[model samples]
Target chain A: MITIELNGQQQPLPTGSTVSDLLSTIGSDGKSVAVLVNQQIIRPENRPTLMLQEGDQVELLIFAGGG
Target chain B: MDLLQLGSHSFSSRLILGTGKFSNAAVMLQAVRASGAQLVTVALRRFNREQAEDDLFGPLSTIEGVTLMPNTSGASTAAEAVRAAHISRELSGSAFIKVEIHPNPQHLMPDPIETFEAARILAKEGFLVMPYITADPVLAKRLEEVGCAAVMPLGSAIGSGQGLANAAMIELIIRESSIPVIVDAGLRSPSEAAHAMEMGCGAVLVNSAVAVAGNPPEMAEAFAEAVAAGRKAFRAGLMQKSGSAIATSPLTAFLGATL
Candidate 1:
């Protein structure tokens, strides 16, 4: 198991857990978010293939109304 | 009326709405529908699941003929703005992005160098870059050369409600820009929006003036009518202003004498 920061909260995930797994674990479709792993944005197509490691910081950003 | 063209896209409405400062998402949607704005701007931020599950996009999607124009509001540098643009594209599924790089939180004045840099990169990446910039004629032309879809120049400081403190500079930008010139920020009323159109701006993006008004929906409607009226006035051609007051009636007709 490796610890990762998910949306500012530290959580432990099994070794070799990809972004897709993270989304599934959180009950999200990954459709409404822009995920960044270690400060690099992970495209939706690559989310399933990109694996998270120990101490990896992940950020999921959502779109809000703006001016 | 001719269509308002920005890059390859054309829109009938010359007023672009900003979704910030509304009382709520529901109220925002109502005002947007009332405004008749085809393109609306939204910000990209960390997805907060705790906030009411009613995401802004879900409600916004119900309004037909509306396109999402996400803005990089919090980005302070060109790289950050570029990253935000990519994120916005992936999230919003729209090619239109508003590049707003304001490092200074006090005034929220967009950084010109950063804006130009971001516009250049985003334009090459096949994104329609609309950069918010100061009312500088030269920078407006530069952004055009960089392949920006449009130039959004400030009428005054952001959210100031001062109403075109830089009207002459904005006019100069409008005159020099080959692409669309959208006057963004610092417009407080429909009359100010009309004034921007009369100065030959392609469109005006207003937020606070309507969102913070006594009645957001009604204010939106007022702005819509004002933009249409201003565009019509521009198309009709405005009379030249002169130092001497020329009588509407022929000077000789009223006096029964020739000047």
Candidate 2:
């Protein structure tokens, strides 16, 4: 199992899951958003294929029209 | 020149100036006037309560008809950015915001996740969100889809004066984006600003470049001229590139053969 932090909350994911897998499991809405793994921005193309490691911290930010 | 429409505000000048790093308020005001920039960026922070008079706000407040774009310069989190935006609204009475979330002070690189998160919240709250981000095409599209007035992508690291480090990415952003793409940060000279405009950017935000110059007013005028020239060039349409060099000599000439 791998531990990840989403917006500061720690959660566990299935072992050997990638960031894409984790995003899918969490049911992201696919809006205009950015993902950071261990404080480094993960490019969109690499998001789906990049594998996750144990104790990895992930933060996903969604940019939406607010005003 | 096409007016830059940010939220409800429309500005004719594409050069956005920042109110920082100036030697004094007079110089700042003079520089701003010379630049002909309608939108000016100001940082939101606590003023020294002990001081009898704060000079920073006075000079900025006196500038007539210029829209004050308050930035969350020190904020590192979404919540902080949001709070800073609100404070700016109260202080300036304008919904215009430059959402900046830089957790790392050393490089001042924006935290993309935090910036996006803050942008979403701020936009939802009815603030004109203009995020300063890295030259990431995906991020630019994401920001646009979320209702940002414009996306301000940096030419290089903030204050580094490293001009247009991510040229390809910036070009991609300009090509794909429907809204304005303002090249912001790391611009050290008027030429850099002009280059950004020539690359089809809607505008360029400059601060350190003008402020740090030996003569701020002269530098500001130079930038204004450069921006104008660049915009004119862009509107005039740049020449198309050719992949391979073409020979002037025709095939018939070669066949007729003079050696």
Candidate 3:
């Protein structure tokens, strides 16, 4: 298992978990969410190819109400 | 048609709606529809499974003619805002980004320096940057010079509903700015929106005024009408004010005994 930071919180994932796998584990279908790894956007097509390693900084953002 | 032109995009409604402070998504959507706002503002928040309903992109997308203008509200610095803009562009596929960098939440006053930096960079990156700033004419002009799509000066503090406390400065901005001057905050009623438009603002953004009203949808409709009326009134030309009253009828001898 490898530990990665998800939205500022530590989360444990299996070894070599891809971005898609992480989203699936979190019960998100990867819709309407922006995934960033190390401050770089991981596009939808690349989510399956991008592998998560230990200490990877991951952030998933969605649009919320604002003025 | 008299469209509010921002960058290369045109919008029929001058009343830009904010998606915050609503009781729920349903009512928010109702207000969005009733407001007829083609451009709406939203923020980037961390996705939590427990609060999946907080995500507004899907629901707002369903509303036709609604374009997302994601704001960099949570960012305290230029770097953070720039990063958020990039991510938001990736998500929304829209070039519009509202550069709102208020470091201290107490007053919610945008940091002019950071906002200008973010707007300059974002505009150069080919994004239509609409910067929310204080009602400072100098700053507004500077942002315009940096290629911003529009300058959104606060009517007062964010969410305060003070109703154009900074009207004087805002008017100065409108007079000097070549780009759209949008009053983006602190509006309480439809009249205030109309007043802003009458004062020559290109657009007005409202959130708390509609979201907290007794009937949000009705209030939204009222604001939309007021904005249109004010814009029309402005286009038709407003009469100048005078210190003394001027007689409408010929003060001629019609009422007098002598011709």
Candidate 4:
């Protein structure tokens, strides 16, 4: 099992849990949103099939309109 | 053209540019340069991790004589806006804060109450506050009361580029504001920007229009020239409104009529 911390929330996931797997678990629509891993932005193209490692930190950001 | 004094910086160009929606960093840089904009708006956020080197901040930082007006674009409430302002001040080392508080994402309108609250707090804290608001005259006055450097009333919904949606309110704001009134957002073309300037707006902020143009650099240059011309015309004073054409008769003709 790998410890996945999402937006400061800690959770345990099965080993080899890819970013796709995490998104499926989290129910993200994958539109107008950005994903970050360990303080690094993960682009959409790389979000799928990217395996997770131990103690991985993830953040999902959704952009909205503002002046 | 009037030069607006905001905080410690003085801006001669009335065209405030936003650093977003660029096709590339090079295009953004070129467009900014061509725009002759002394003040550029940038969104405050973490660095993108995909690129080896973050080109956005670096190029913008290197732009000589351009002041970075970092905006609290993501903040939803007064507290969040204040926090973002604090973080921006720390990162940019500037006291200028563009206080933006919008809870809704669809219309992107300012929450007048929250914006006013944040502005009051930020003003008391000695930060130069420029609140982005709707073209509401009363809210403009409130912002002014709170010591905002300028009131940026939106010309229309942000990123809409649908042109001025609240012309009457904008006119009222321009008429009533003691400090500079900058028309920000929803300006689609050079004509719209020029029209706002002609309406006595101290400045206008444009982003999506130029950034999303086919040739951003060329578009930037066009906007710069258009703004300059508009300001010049405004200073020169435009012609008076007339319902119908009248024959021009000199005052000397009055003496002949009397005779």
Q: What tens digits encode model 1's per-residue C-alpha lDDT throughout A1-67?
A: 9999988999899999999999888777887778999888889899999999999999988878789
Please give, for residues B160-183, the per-residue lDDT of candidate 4 as tens digits. Answer: 998888878999998998888888
Best DockQ among the predictions, by candidate number? 3
Residue B8, model 4, lDDT: 65
Which regions in candidate 1 have their CA more than 4 angstroms from the true location? A14-16, A48-50, B52-54, B250-259
Candidate 4 chain B lDDT trough over 10 residues, lowest sum: B46-55
Steric clash pairs (candidate 2): A65-B146, A66-B123, A66-B124, A67-B123, A67-B126
Task: Give candidate 4 misplaced runs (Cα > 4 Å).
Answer: A1-67, B52-55, B248-259
After best superposition, candidate 1 residue A11: deviation in angstroms?
Answer: 2.1
Error in Å for residue B106 of model 3: 0.9
Instruction: Report the lDDT tens digits of candidate 3 across residue range B1-259.
Output: 9999998899989999999999999999999999999999999999998999999999999999999999999999999999999999998999999999999979999999999999999999999999999999999999999999999999988889899999999999999989999999999999999999999999999999999999999999999999999999989999999999999877767656754
**Where in model 2 is the C-alpha error above 4 Å?**
A1-67, B49-54, B244-259
Residue B25 accuracy (lDDT) in model 2: 66
Q: Could you tell me how far off, in angstroms, the CA of residue B13 lies in candidate 3 after the best superposition?
A: 1.0
CA lDDT of B147 in candidate 1? 94
Taking the tens digit of each residue's C-alpha lDDT, what string does model 1 give over B165-196? Answer: 99998888877878989999999999999999
Ordered list by TM-score, greatest first: 3, 1, 4, 2
TM-scores, all candidates, are 0.93, 0.74, 0.97, 0.77
lDDT of each: 0.91, 0.80, 0.94, 0.79
Descending-lDDT candidate ranking: 3, 1, 2, 4
- Greater lDDT among 1 and 2 belongs to 1
Top lDDT prediction, candidate number: 3
The regions of model 3 sitting more than 4 angstroms off are B250-259
The true-versus-predicted C-alpha distance at residue B102 of model 3, in Å, is 0.5
The digit string of per-residue lDDT tens for model 4 on A8-55 reads: 778788899888788767654443335667866566678787898888
